[model samples]
Target: MIPLLVCDDSAMARKQLIRALPAEWPVSITQATQGEEALAAIRQGLGRVVLLDLTMPVMDGYQVLAQLRAEGLSCKVVVVSGDVQEEAMRRVQELGALGFIKKPAPAEEVRATLQRLGLLDLEPPLAPTAPRPELALKVNFRDALREVSNVAMGRAAALLAQVLGTFVRLPIPQVNIFEVSELHMALLDAQRGQRLSAVCQGFIGDAIAGEALLLFHDLEIGAIANLLGWQPQNETETSEMLLDLASILTGACLSGIAEQIDVRFSQGHPQLLGQHSAIEQLIRLNRERWKNTLAVEISYSLEGHAVHFDLLLLFTEDSLSRLTKKIYYLMEQE
Candidate 1:
């Protein structure tokens, strides 16, 4: 195995780097506390690549690098430093460093780069991505994930109906994959009384569960009332009904997802996003982190009724791939 050395003054930084490396990297790694130790290690001809930090005690990275280069050291050097100044990076390149990794580099990105450079062996072949079908369906990768969501959601609804002692109707989940810029347009559509009242619970598993929004749009709520043989006198009464509806819906959705993922999730209580301009209000409430919405909205319809609802499952773009892999993995398991 090719040996790599990590040279940094701080243990915490080293730990973070180690944690980010892919589990399957083939290289055996060693650590050096400072530039002097790193130089000593290099003299011993131990490692092929030396990951050098910029700042160090006794001997800084620049001095160590200059000395090593002057002496014609052949080990590949990758500068790993928090300093992102253009000059620093240029200088590292001038000193014969093979690569530069910004401090706090995302783990997956780093692993991929290393693997491409032949520093690490290849990982197992991932399951094939879903192919374009003969029918030429107008769907993206998001749609495939939505199908996974649908199976999980159906199971969730059944679980909720069992808990609530009421016949809960779930609509087929509709997924929309739009950029952050499209969120404003989606809100405009959702605001024109198109928003559903939903109760939501948060569940955790592999990554910490972010908040979950369980909701039904206007049509689903009306249909549910009709299915249950209740005539809600006003919108307020209809909204109140959705409190229980949202709870049941959330239960079903989480249950389905958890079952597919083969893991349990910690859940939180559902809440109301009911208002005259409910969509706008809900978006504003989560404005800080949800500044840009890459949302997955699911709608449930009451069985044998016209009442249908909308549930918005929002996540950032970064998490979308993890979500996809999880769904795909689950599908393969089945």
Candidate 2:
């Protein structure tokens, strides 16, 4: 049996990758939550082959690859990441990775990759003595939502990077169930007295209904406009730039979530919520309408700039149960 390490911060992602592995392959698997642990495991000769993830808190995949090369650790690595930006794959390859498999990994694709790497013999099937159960992942409601949001945010970041010609740094999304009154406190990005501008769009499809909002720091507008080669000379031009950015981020993110849950969302035209408004005021205006909300807040920043923004998805209480049901169905599938 082979000793393989699956390193990813998200439990859901780890489970998905394990599911994508060829069931017929004989292997002993070790799970690592971050690059540091993965490195430790490799040093112990536990990782003959490593399936690595790029975005993690303590240490990222790039750091792991660099460390492996520095220590001259002999191990095969295949990067599995949600961040599909072009440079992501290129950097991994340069750092000594066999290849990359993007998120929502398909089982056959994983098999094909391993076969190409000469890691699997697929032409002749070997029957097992008994049935092997799928990875036993006890994912709760919040983590499941976070995983969905994680994949969605990655797609949005890739889209924004292409539009602005820069890399977008992704953070694990914060998922919560909040009373209308407590919602504003969660958005602490505006606490430094930085004024904020926002765009809001409403979406509805089948049992899913939510609002997608993009909150941008007023100060970052000029830098963002400069990147897109649209220097905002006037208030109207600045507003136009803000709208364009919101459309790209919110549209891509919302669509990503919809695709995961197998639904189609018809989004309303994004409206500029307000310029230079407090986050509290923004939440308060809609507070009376909702008793509770399931919020998935994704924060993103540019690679080399102070450009930062928050993409928020607010789902009504009525939609929460349906959303979790969909997640359960997703997890149950082969």
Candidate 3:
């Protein structure tokens, strides 16, 4: 039997890829959570076909592909990522990926790719089996939230791109419900080893209220200002530039989400939490103030620029009941 490997930081993504495989394909599957592990597994002759994800900690899929090329390893690689920007696709292909599949891939697309690669024989498609009702509902709800986040993020990205006069690359927004204390863990990539500058804006409406935070690495401020066509000569000028950028992004994102959920938000003024502060310490100060929260994290990177930042929307636990209802209603409308 041929060995096939799935490499992604997300367990959910790996499971989806497994489920998407042809039922009769004669292959043993292996999983790796990062690029280094995936490389090691491939070197050990563990996989002839690899499913890869692009964004990961420690090492990313691009680095893995570079290493594979350098070692003259021959393996069929298909990139599976939520970073669907054209540049990303072209980069992976240049690095020798056999093909690209965007994230939240439909099972049919996966099967088609395998068949096209001559890895799977063309066979009649399997009859769809109905999922358990509860499981189906859960999946629908999650997908709905993701869809909403995707739309809102695009709207925000568009505005930012317009302001900076550059294309903005957006990752798939990550949505989760967790205790307030666990918030810091979810932001490991964004806050890793960087003193962050953050701004917070609160919004409230009938039965729903939340906060939106914009986080930037302190070192990136100068590049960000230059991108915005500003030359800040003083600390105050730099601070103002940061606040302006944060306001534009946060307002557009929050407003877009609010419009979709059919709620009008009364937004508060944006407040700088502190400059050069640890993300954990900033959140810890408010730890007792919040319980569980539904967090939507969006990371934006500028194409051809060194500026990258994170936008985190935090909805309070009490607001989730209404938020879920709104999402369900939006799903129905779709």
Candidate 4:
């Protein structure tokens, strides 16, 4: 069996890839949770062909590729990542990746990609077989949710990046089950008393329900407008710019997550929650409606621009049971 390394920060993501591989392919699989480990394994001949995730801690797949190329290491690499932006795909190809596959990679797509890369021989399925039990267990709920949100955010970031003509820096998603107090404190501390603006929109479908908040730093609005080659000459134009950004980000992000779980969220109209307002006031306004919440936070930045945005997917307390049920089957089945 050939040695294959699956490197990803999320255990759920790693297993999904493992299960998606051509069932009859001849390979002894090893796993790495971060890029440094992946590099060490590759150097030790543990990964002749690698399936690598782009977003990870300590090091990323892109860094690993650069290191390998710098040292003149020879190995076939296929990037399996959630960042499907044209820029991301182009960069990895230039960095020596054999091919690219988007997240929740389907079995058929995996087969075709591998075949095209000459990594898999054309063969027929002999029988329906189960993946190893170790790879089939239910992953930790928090990690699973973060993985889902990670993939979801990648799509959103790609879209936003395309519109703005900038590369979006994706942070590791933060997942929390927070009491109302904890939520307030968390947001306040993260904001550091900076003046901010936000767009609030609610969504629901089937048993899943949540609200998405897109928070923008007040001072960065002008910089963002400049990126689009426009200068806001009046209050209305400035507000229009902010609203347009909020709409694209909020809609694309919510749609990404909804697509992952096979649910269609009917999103309510977005409203300006506040303009040049303190986050504390925003939290106070929201406190009455939140008791316990599932908060998934993603911080996005641009590669060479002074622009940042925080997107929060806040699932209400009542939505917990149904959301958990949805996530339970999501990772297990994938």
Best by lDDT: 4
lDDT per residue as tens, model 1, 1-334: 5567778765544555665565555455777868889888888876577888775668878887898988887687878775444556777889887777875556877776676666664334333334212112233445445554655554565554454334444333466656544765675665455645545555566663545665455555555676556788986777667766666666666666666556577777666756545556655665665555456675544434555455666765555566667755643332
What are the per-residue Cα lDDT tens digits for candidate 3 across 1-334? Answer: 6778889776555655677676666666788989999999999998699999877778888899999999998889999876555666788999999998875567889989888888774234444544312111223556567656765676677778778877787776788887865886776567777878888888899788888888988888888888877999987787788788888999988877787778998989888877656466657776765578888888898989888989999888888899999977865543
- In each prediction, how many residue pairs overlap at the backbone (N, C-alpha, C within less than 3 A)? 18, 0, 0, 0
Q: Give the residue spans of candidate 3 off by over 4 A.
A: 122-209, 216-222, 229-306, 320-334
lDDT of 2 by residue, 54-153 (tens): 9898999999999999999999999988888887778899999998888878898888889898877524545553434438867676777788888888
Task: Score candidate 2 by TM-score against the native.
Answer: 0.94
Residue 174 miss distance in model 2 (angstroms): 1.4
Q: In model 1, what lDDT does residue 24 have? A: 55
Give the Cα error of residue 147 in candidate 3, in Å.
13
* Whole-model lDDT values for every prediction: 0.61, 0.84, 0.78, 0.86
Q: How accurate is candidate 2 locally (lDDT)?
A: 0.84
Deviation from native of the Cα of residue 250 in model 1, angstroms:
1.5
**TM-score on alpha carbons, each prediction:** 0.46, 0.94, 0.62, 0.94
In candidate 4, which residue pairs get closer than 3 Å at backbone N, Cα or C atoms, i.e. clash? none
Q: Candidate 3: lDDT of 273?
A: 76
lDDT string, candidate 4, 122-228, tens digits: 23434445665547545898999999999889989998998899999888999999899999888776676777787788899887787888888888888898888
